[model samples]
Target: MRVRYLGPPAQAPDPLDGRYVFEAGREYVVLELHAESDGSTLLRIEPSRGSLAGLYNSRYFEQVSDVIPSLWGVVTLPGGGVLLGPPKWLSGEFWELMMEREPEAEAEFEAVRDEITAEDPVARSS
Candidate 1:
């Protein structure tokens, strides 16, 4: 999957520090935060459309969920899985950081949205 930067670029946390799984279409994206001894949070992601109610059935998901807090975010199809991180505040913050990293890309996305709306005159009226 292409990783599109929707916000400012920020350094990605260490890979060893967290778990990340992104299943764009099949299910919800899962994030696991592992707090380090140094007071740092490790993050991990898992993509699944299935219900979290039975998440424990999956050893992988269970293991991660068991260790750290899990965050959930919905994703629209054809788009990449949403980045869900622990502590609700980080969600918006990270998105902002990502968008800041790619100002031009964000502009292009807006342009595309405008173009689509313009082409659909009926949409404009509604």
Candidate 2:
């Protein structure tokens, strides 16, 4: 139930990790479910980013029942808001999937980091 922010400055900031700018001129806020242990679920909000554009470009939100425990449906609010919670059947499915995929996901994430660093000279210098 704990919410964590993810995204660039001016949109989501402070005490949050995992924030990133997916593309220019567009921003998103990613929140993670911290209560889970095996893996975790994410809830993203794209306030001011518009609905159709945000939904198409944003990667922080998805309906992946196989990876999120008990996740059923998401509620979309006005102004590009969203809420994610578990359903009945998929409540524990996420944990199992996360446990199975954590290592691979971590490796993939690290590889992405390395690739980004190699591509961005500024990042490589830092």
Candidate 3:
């Protein structure tokens, strides 16, 4: 998936986490998306900038293509993460954690999305 960094949060940066020094308007490839039961979400991205590759809250960027194809089940992800998705949209902290922990995250996500779309042409929203 693709996303564009909107810049750091409006308020002061967190004292602990600091701030995300992302280039505003720059586009990044979303390696993985993770959501929380509380409705919070994080995105794993390979930025177009320096070595800031890591997980950042979804509030940091805007989904370029929000669609996440449905289908798939208890899949294995790195960092000991698990995801039961698509129905949950494009956010699942477990999924993004899995994506970062696993080297083949983007490929795996593509495969699942493709497989689901192949079966059901109409799926999740963007």
Per-model TM-score on C-alpha atoms: 0.21, 0.24, 0.48
Predicted candidate 2 versus true structure: per-residue lDDT over 32-100, tens digit per residue: 222233233333332332221111222333332223323225554454544453332124454344346
Which window of ten consecutive residues has the lowest lDDT sum in model 3? Answer: 117-126
Deviation (Å) of 68 in candidate 3: 4.9
Q: Model 3: per-residue lDDT, tens digit, 1-126?
A: 567777766787852121555678876555456665566666655454333345677776777765444453334446454443443324556356544655465555555545544543232332
Q: Which stretches of candidate 2 lie over 4 Å from their true place?
A: 1-14, 17-101
For model 3, the stretches where C-alpha displacement exceeds 4 angstroms are 15-19, 48-52, 67-126
For each candidate, C-alpha RMSD in Å? 17.7, 14.4, 8.3
For candidate 3, what's the RMSD? Answer: 8.3
lDDT, candidate 1, residue 28?
22
- Candidate 2 positional error at 46, Å: 21
Candidate 2 TM-score over all chains jointly: 0.24
Question: Which one wins by TM-score: 1 or 2?
Answer: 2
Pairs of residues at least 3 apart in sequence or in different chains that clash in candidate 3? 34-92, 34-93, 35-91, 35-92, 35-93, 66-126, 67-126
Error of 2 at 95 (Å): 12
Of 1 and 2, the candidate ahead on lDDT is 2
